[model samples]
Target: MRFKSYWRTTVVAAIFLHFFVCLGLALALPLLDFEGAPIAAQEMEVVDLSEGDDGNADTEKPEPPEVKPPAPEPPAPEKPEPEPEELVLPVEMSPTEAAELDETVAEMQKQEEEAKKRGEDGKDVRPPAPPNQEVGTIISSGMTPDTRGTDFRGTVGVLVDVDAQGKIVGVFLSRKSGRFVVDQIVLNALKTFKFEPALDMNGNPMKTKRLINFPFDGSGPHPFDDDENKRMRAKRELFLRERQQQGNAPAN
Candidate 1:
């Protein structure tokens, strides 16, 4: 009976201890949860405790090394636009035309030597009339220089030499236009002039001389025209347009 009493007492003590310990555990769990909530979460930072040159432990995260935006890359250099190509125009005169002129000049020189040797300079003769009332035309209707950049504009007097067949042999500039280029142009045009030969006072076609004025001013067109001159005029118009595109002046 004594032993049984002892065992019962021991069991009662164990039950009370278990109940109190369980209650304490339950209370502790709620306190732990409340203290350790997300709001109370802790962050740890490792700081270097090394002293700075000034002998003070540096704190403040060393100021993050003064970050400045990387300097903007230098703007790309702009490429210069290429210039337009110049226009190439036709040649001034053809080789064939040059050869023909050379031949004509030689024939004219021969005629001059023969005339001088014949002593026919001091003869009495009637001056040749224009082809106006005759059977042919004299001068063309316009003055054509065949080239650009002529520097003379005035009345150019010329002396023409005609052959017995009513053909033009040569032309000489009795009066110049003060510019060599202008004089040459006029001389070339005059070589194309045709007139009725002079009358030997007997109404015969004799080789003689004629004087005519070639005006090349803006006031009016020259009193001469021909197929060759017309062609040169059209070329001149086209040439000026090409010059404008090339940004250049005609050869002086």
Candidate 2:
């Protein structure tokens, strides 16, 4: 009987606790007061103007006046004067002055000769190589084929009148390798040459001559031959492959 009484008391206590909790929660919640002061909604104001009326109600903008620049003054008249008569003077050159004049002329001639010599000695002259050769040199000295082995042969020379910018202005076969193939090789190899230009007396760059030559390998084709396409293609492929591997791996 005592156990039964205890169990009944516990059950009744649990039911009362649950009822109290629910009732407290319901009482704690805020009440919705729909009957209190209501919010007022604002209405947009509309205005209408006649076709001839300005939109500003209290102020009107004035029209701008036309502006005219002042007139330019007339140009001054040119003045003309009389021509003067020519005058002659009975001046005589001294003996010393005459001697100096002769010396001056002689010195100029000597200078001209010296210049010519210097030009011949590779002093102020460009090489007499072909344009292509000059271009090759300017672009890359390596492009200028070497005259080493007969099998790996080429000529060495210059092209004259190469523009200051290294463009071939003229090609001269100065040091020919005696083979048409060799000569053509020199010419063809120069197509890629470029120059920084040679300077003149005034330090300004001027077109000049250059010289180059090549040798013939009885077997090898001319350097200028269009047979380098295969080599060029291989180089291109290699470059592309290198670039392809240069970046980080794409996100998987």
Candidate 3:
């Protein structure tokens, strides 16, 4: 009986030890320090951000700005003040006076119609000529440059005459030369020119043309007729008389 008790005790002790050791190991394992576990990856659904067919997002959009209220219309402008009515004198209408007024108005209308017709037809009218105040002509002095080296010089005058018709009726040199070439040149030069008709004392239209003179200097060809020689001699005698008078006068 003693030996059987001892074996039973030993087996019980072994089982108890084994149970306590397991318990202690479980508790110690909890106390041991270890690194923290890695974080777990979470699953998220992917979404595309492309524009929709409607060109607007499926979600509600933000509200738009509110429109401002329109300004009140301005009051209509005040009507302009009525003009004061003119006072009219009451008079009995006379047949004779009415007839005279109608005749005067008709005459005025006829004159206006005639003027219009003339203007449209471009006729029965003439432009007023430019005013002529008689600008003097250029007269050549009796001097020739020695460079022209001529034996004689001729004096010529352009006699311009104005007519009542305001036309250039005549243009001739008071003294004529047989030289056709020189005469023609002088005539042609004058012909090319035009002048505004001068006004007479009565302010009526009068034709006027310029007269130019080329004084005979002691150069160029001296083609003089008998009449011209006589006139020249007379001019010389007059010049001599003037000179003698001047010589007799006392010096001022």
Candidate 4:
């Protein structure tokens, strides 16, 4: 009986020890699971951070290109000024040349004075020829002689002196017509005569003298015919008779 009781006690002690070991094992298993899970999560977060860093590096902006400065411009060239022209002077004159110039000037002045004297003396120099009438032509223009009004009828002669310019210078009666009126008519006609200028041996004009004769009485192609003269003479006689009769009549 005692041996059997001791064996029962040993068995109960082994059972209680086994029960405590199992409870301890259960609590240790929970702690190990929690610690292992946290370690794995920390490794995953580290990989994701490494990938994000690579992506940010690709999206970053690039640096700007370096600018090159332009080259400096060259300075402009300067213009040159024009040079002055050279001057040339003539040689001085010799003593002989100076003397010749003085002589030439004196000769020129003397020549000028002589020319002036000749011009002054030329005014009084006369032409070498006398004046004459044109050939085959007489100066009978502007003369109308009327012998019918008077009883006196005669021939008249005149002498005329003409100048170098064909102008009448002087007139003289060489023969009288017996009547004063007839003489006056001849004188006036002679004064109006024009002539051609006569030339001397040198072919230069000069003054000249000439003589002319005129007749009245309807003779030798005279200006008045015989019939007209008779008619005028009869009229004049009648006028004279009337005047005499009037004079002889007694005053009223």
Candidate 5:
């Protein structure tokens, strides 16, 4: 009995294993058939590259595009030349007027010739000199040395015109003293001066022009001497003292 039970259990496990193997083979059959089938090739459209769009062969190459040069610019218009204006001639003078003009020109020429002759002769002719004129002498002069002027020295030439009455008619400085003060001093002195009338050949008083020189020497001893200065100082001191005494006495 133990042997028969073992045999029956073994038969039952074998039968179950055989059913599972058959079911696995049945599920795998469609996948194996799909993998073994040959795939069909897809149909492609053919292109004829040797023909153009109209379906004809284009044997000739395309011509290069025509390149024309730029058009020439239009020329500018020329300007017109200006017309010349008409010239007007001067009117002809009458015969009498022309003759008068000629005569006037001749007269001018004649006068010019006479003037030239006179000028040439004048070169040789000496002007008549005043008959034996003598320069006037100074009778009285108001000129005094300038005490205020310091070490200044110069000479002045004065042109003095004397009248017939021994009076100075005009006086002008012919040479400058280089100092305005000196010049003014000299001029003022000359105005106050009296002159002896000039005499002609007939011994009659006559007008005359003369140049007089006035000189100032700063080194001279008129006011700058030591002795003179001391004397002046003493005099000024005495005057001041006298004035002071008088003022003091006036209190009475």
Candidate 6:
């Protein structure tokens, strides 16, 4: 019996020693880390092995994504040219007056051309004061009535430039009549005028300028301007004196 009891006691003691050793080993395993912390308490690190789509990490920046430049804008269109302007004319002279003026201008031009062909004929042989406005030629007055019911009246001063051969080379306005139609009619009529050629000191024909004031009223412009009358008087006296001298001269 003593032997059996002692054998039971030994078996119980061996079982208790085995259980304590297993528990101690389980607790000591978590302290195996050098920092004495549990394995799960430490932070775990992760690494990426991903590369470029071409399988190489340094694959030429994917060809710079094909950065295309913008296209240029189209050129602008050109503009069209402007149209011409039309003038409205007013008839201030009667049929008879117009016809007379035309005939006079034509006759004067014909006479001047004939005189020029004849080479310094006795036509412009006298040096009348202020030149031009010879005694024989009758130049029609400027500025006929504004037959239009407008009753517009103003003085239109015109500057005429006559050439050595009595041709109307140029005509310009020295003063405006403030009426466009009236001014234009005066300008056009003045163009048809011809002057007697002025004479130089040697009695040779010379170019000259004259300013004539056309004063308009209820009866259109007066027949002649002041300057015109002055020149006419001077020229008529000179012409009469020349004629008297010729008459007094002894026959050759």
Error of 1 at 120 (Å): 36
Cα displacement (angstroms), candidate 3, residue 88, comes to 67
lDDT of 3 by residue, 1-252 (tens): 344358788999999999999999999998887877889999988666666434446666667799999999999999999874322221455899656645644554354345335555667332222354322122111122221343335745555565554345655454445565555545554443333344443344455543344444544433222322243345445655666788799999
Deviating ranges (above 4 Å) for candidate 1: 1-149, 219-252
What are the TM-scores, per candidate, against the unseen true structure?
Answer: 0.31, 0.28, 0.24, 0.30, 0.33, 0.37
Ranking by lDDT: 6, 5, 1, 4, 2, 3
* Candidate 6, 68-131: lDDT as tens digits: 7888778777667655322223246788966775564455445434533433544442222344
Expressed as tens digits, the lDDT of each residue in 138-202 for candidate 5 is 34334444525645566665666677877776665656778788777777656545556665544
Q: Give the TM-score of candidate 3.
A: 0.24
Identify the candidate with maximal lDDT.
6
The models' CA-based lDDT, in order, is 0.53, 0.50, 0.49, 0.52, 0.57, 0.58
lDDT of 2 by residue, 94-119 (tens): 88965674564455435434534545
Question: Model 2, residue 241: what's the lDDT?
Answer: 60
lDDT head-to-head 5 vs 6, winner:
6
Clashing residue pairs in candidate 4, if any?
A: 129-205, 129-206, 130-198, 130-206, 130-207, 132-196
Go through the candidates in order and give the clash count of each: 6, 41, 4, 6, 0, 0
List the lowest-lDDT window of 10 residues for candidate 3.
135-144
Q: Which residue pairs does candidate 3 place in steric collision? A: 152-219, 152-220, 153-219, 153-220
Better by TM-score, candidate 4 or 3: 4
Report the lDDT of model 3 for residue 219.
44
All candidates: CA RMSD (Å): 24.8, 30.6, 31.0, 45.2, 36.3, 22.6
Deviation from native of the Cα of residue 150 in model 5, angstroms: 3.9
Task: Tell me the TM-score of model 1.
Answer: 0.31
Give the distance in Å from residue 14's predicted Cα in candidate 2 to where it truly belongs.
Answer: 99
